[model samples]
Target: MSRTSRTRLRLVGALTGALLAVVAADPAAQAHCDDPPTLADLAQRHGRYFGSATDNPELTDTAYTKILGSEFDMITPGNGMKWYATEPQQGVFDWTAGDAIVDLARAHHQKVRAHTLVWHSQLPGWLTGKEWTADALRAVLKKHIQTEVRHYRGKVYSWDVVNEAFNEDGTYRETVFYKTLGPGYIADALRWAHQADPKAKLYLNDYNIEAVGPKSDAYYGLAKELKAQGVPLDGVGLQAHLALQYGYPTTLEDNLRRFARLGLDTALTEVDVRMLLPATEEKLAQQADWYRDMTEACLAVRRCVGITIWDHNVG
Candidate 1:
């Protein structure tokens, strides 16, 4: 099955099993940690930096609380708390889901990472006007960032101020944000986010930039330029979505090193080793090796702060 289908099945299972709490409190030997090199142990050994994405209704469940308490120092609410879930209407902002996530993180003394203050994806219909000129669109964007960031001020440890602005070939994707506000929109978004919460660390997040290639070079160059231009970008987030089949990039260390040379903190966000279709024993072993390499790479980098998987279980 595809990842989407797998995700749907998991969601259904989660909803049904919401009441069935896992009795085991052994955070070091949980389902995802059954392997020898548990993510919990790896994180504790590397840095005190470990995190996970969760959206269960029982935010304070035994299993979750146990794992989070022992293993995770940071927590991201996956997609349960983003623009669409928080603000479905134009000016009517709802803080139900996101606020719950913040509260849970705070309760556990975990650092909260707020994703995607500005992105072309998951935008509400009200903000999708084709007629709005650049100036008008700028006004809307500013309000969106300011309102949301200010509300979560002092709460969020880092915010993905801008996400996936560049294509795989070192060029800006023709996103609505780009079309209306031009490439400057990224810098503008960072500035706006900084103004909203000066203390919050702002990051630029993108996928497929884990290796030193055209896409990686594009992100690195942009980050260097942003730093030079005095943009308030605090970190660079590498969304490490790896596969267990073909092979993950072995050049991840070089990639992280290059980003670190730019004097910015790095994070391995949204990591997962997918093997949804049939899997052989060799494939599973390869998957384990993939996870090991990623962990080792992140651990090696002094500037690499944390590594978070997108979803704990793909299928």
Candidate 2:
């Protein structure tokens, strides 16, 4: 599933034309890529960083590595830092996968956006295997969040403190954390992450929140509340995982603006314009249009810090 669920390349415009530019501000800073100016170069001009989500296995492929190293300036470990990968046992922890990707990013002169700290999916059996009282669960949660964030401190740019907390209808998802710790767990997670790494930005990342809708509304309300309480919430990640069949989020720009209004950074994280199989040229053109529109929307907003393509697939 990890390999097949690949987020294939969706370039800025036509795949053939410019392929996007990446010249340094001084043109004397030295070129990272031999020719094409990467999306990272283009985004840097606007004080932003473009990046992608990569896995440990793919680093060996030179073809993919070329783009992974040059096309973007940020790297997201798609699953490396998740609960399962980070903590396979009740008290034990692992950093092999997470460290590999972060090392790759640093080698390429890129910043790291740690994929997530608290999430409902891909949890290790030791965590999801048993039931727990509220207090016990809270302790476990805090320990896990602080442990991981602390380990990656000063290395990562941000952490997806809590991911996909709200559902499509603006209601909370009934995950283990929500079931045991309640909605306040989200706030607690953010605060704990901040304590672990005061310099790192903390974000709530989710898909399908790119537009003005119930899901985004839930985030906006929660972000406002967190700020009023002086919680350490710093950003909102709109995962912008759009499909051609569902149509683009027409209110995307306004949605970004609203988050920025609340004094929080916004990013088009996990961007991928997907379509059904046997895609025609016409469909690909429209797909490119979707990519272009999303890119322009992020660039138009000041607080929309950067964009991260989910990663490219050549297989």
Alpha-carbon TM-score of each model against the true structure: 0.84, 0.92
The per-prediction CA RMSD against the true structure, in angstroms, equals 7.2, 3.2
- lDDT tens digits, residue span 99-198, model 1: 8888888887788888878777878877774567999989988888899999899988989888888888989998888987899999999999999999
lDDT of 2 by residue, 1-315 (tens): 143345555554442222242233346534554666666776776688888888888889999998788777899998899989999998899999999998898899899999899989899998888999999999999999999999999999999999999999999999999999889999999989999999999999998899898999999999999999999988999988888889899999999999999999999888887788788998888888787788778867899999887878665
Which candidate number maximizes TM-score?
2
lDDT for residue 206 in candidate 2, whole number 0-100: 93
lDDT of 1 at 155: 89
- Which 10 residues in a row give candidate 1 its minimum summed lDDT? 14-23
